[model samples]
Target: MATIASQVVLHPTVSQSLKYGSTTLGRDKAYRAIQYFARFYAWYLLSKGDKDAAARWNALKTHLGTARKLLRLGKPMEHLQAALRACLSTGPAVEQVTTIARQISYFGYLTFDAFVWANSIKFWTLNPETSTRVAKISNRFWFAGILFSIVNGVTKSVRLARETKKLQSTQKWGEKTLAAEAERETRLSVLLAAQENTRHQLIIDLLDAWIPATALGITNLNEGALGIFGLITSLIAAQKQWEAVNGKK
Candidate 1:
């Protein structure tokens, strides 16, 4: 969906090892963040949606989300190419459409990375003053990214620990209390679900400045990150064999 990646190519970066290394670390952080979101969204959708939508997105949402985030960050196509290679290496016979999509998007991410980085370097190279301005802004953004991750990670860890403790305590109580608690939980979950969706829409609106329409993918509403890609590849392989037998019959 992104117009930029359509023309991007990723050559191996043996020339500038230091720059490449720093960039790779940044890319990895961004990739993991996206992957976490994707996996979460895929699981959320799978856990929340109808059977059919779940069937399509439940598996690869996490992986795809990572790909989407990396692409948005303007990471290199080499990373994406490697991911695609890894996904396809499992087997050509595998027919997971989502795997294929993830593979294609991986390529898409690479293309995006190459294009953005190439332009960024060129602009900076041709003009030191301009480069300095961009560099300053980029440094601030990078620092912000790191700070955001640290704060978010700590908050989430604490919240999860509390929620888990509550879940555990919920199991120790009497039936009447448990029933009332369960009903309260159901109400709270539903309310949280609505609030979450509303918050998510606001995020999508804000993200549009960075990601555009097409590259946003389906993550605006979904959940899983890692397991989906594996499921997709497995299912595709299974479906291919099924089709092969059906065609013969």
Candidate 2:
């Protein structure tokens, strides 16, 4: 047991505790050491005038404060892990709200195409023979894609909100149990959002590629510029969406 213990690796701060002190020291000393390290890091960031980092540091202090309390009560590793897991599982509300806003804005852009396509009569003024039929068909396809996107967003938001509410209600649960519950809900939300995002991408592909190609076939110049713009914006939106789901910046 002594040989195995000698080979064990703790985090740098934890290892520092053992180096500076001894194993016989109370666990509270370990907790205090960790707390002091976090506070110093937070202070360094604040001194550099980083408000965002400072806020994050404050939140970390809150989480570590909880951990320190748990250690003082002599809670086991399992309880400590649970508290940390719950703290890390949360994604800010601002992120989700921003995503929803972008989705709505994309819907508005598609609506612009819908309006252009619906006015097939204007196309007839440019070319009397084929423009009218082509315009009507193009309008129908754009409208269908737009409507599908709207429904997808609304349903996904409602489902996520319901699940989030259910998760929030478990705040009073025991440490281990609440951690498991929060992790489960977080995973479920990600999966659900991912599935819907896939569907949304399909709709966007139709709008950006298919409808634009059709528009170029019918109206020529006016719709061509819009198509190019749509393609560019769709690519940007796709990158953002992918990053959001993958938990990247």
Candidate 3:
């Protein structure tokens, strides 16, 4: 989760500092961060070191003692194996009497545990002959991949959640606009259909009439057309005026 938290906590500046640690300023920042992390980790570890923790730790050590005693006795290999086997069948009480047993027995379990811890910190890094301060420092920063992945996963989860919120909001707005447009198109189509019907009826009446009274004469043709246009205009104006008057009321 530190990776995600780092996003809002000045990661660029930190990365820059890490990259530029050869410089005095970067070195100072690294020192400060180290001090902070160390203090926090110490407090966390100390809190976990309770009475129950101590008891469990001691019990495990006693289990190791059971294995050590078998080896120290200089028994035959088969006898040693039998002792380790006996510890397992004896139950949890014998958990401290020997090492863990499953399909395989742990060889040199105590030394192996030490080696594993050291490997986690760049094991074999502090060789008596060739070790340097740089190796020691690097070891401290050699974090387990699992722990690193957890931090990254947490950060990514938070980002994805935020992105999802934005995507949902955008979708809602688009849907609302689409619905309103659909309604408007339905209303417009209805109005256009009604006007088209009225126009077709008017044309049919003029075509069917035998007299052709108003449009047949060339001299009256322009005047009739002008009158028709004036009538249409006046009808529109009257409707607008009625609407305005009604609005005032």
lDDT of candidates 1 onward, in order: 0.43, 0.49, 0.38
Question: Candidate 3: where are CA atoms >4 Å away?
Answer: 1-57, 61-114, 117-151, 170-249
Candidate 1 residue runs with Cα over 4 Å from true position: 1-125, 176-249
Better of 1 and 2 by TM-score: 2
Q: Give stretches of model 2 more than 4 Å off.
A: 1-128, 175-182, 188-232, 241-249
lDDT-wise, the better of 1 and 3 is: 1
Q: What's each prediction's TM-score?
A: 0.27, 0.31, 0.18
* Preferred candidate (lDDT higher): 1 or 2: 2
- Largest TM-score belongs to which candidate? 2
Tell me the tens digit of each residue's lDDT in model 1 across 138-246: 4333333333333433444445455645654665454566778788678667555544443433332233222222223323332242334333433333333333333
Better of 2 and 3 by lDDT: 2
On the 0 to 100 scale, the lDDT of residue 65 in model 2 is 47
| Top candidate when judged by lDDT against the true structure | 2
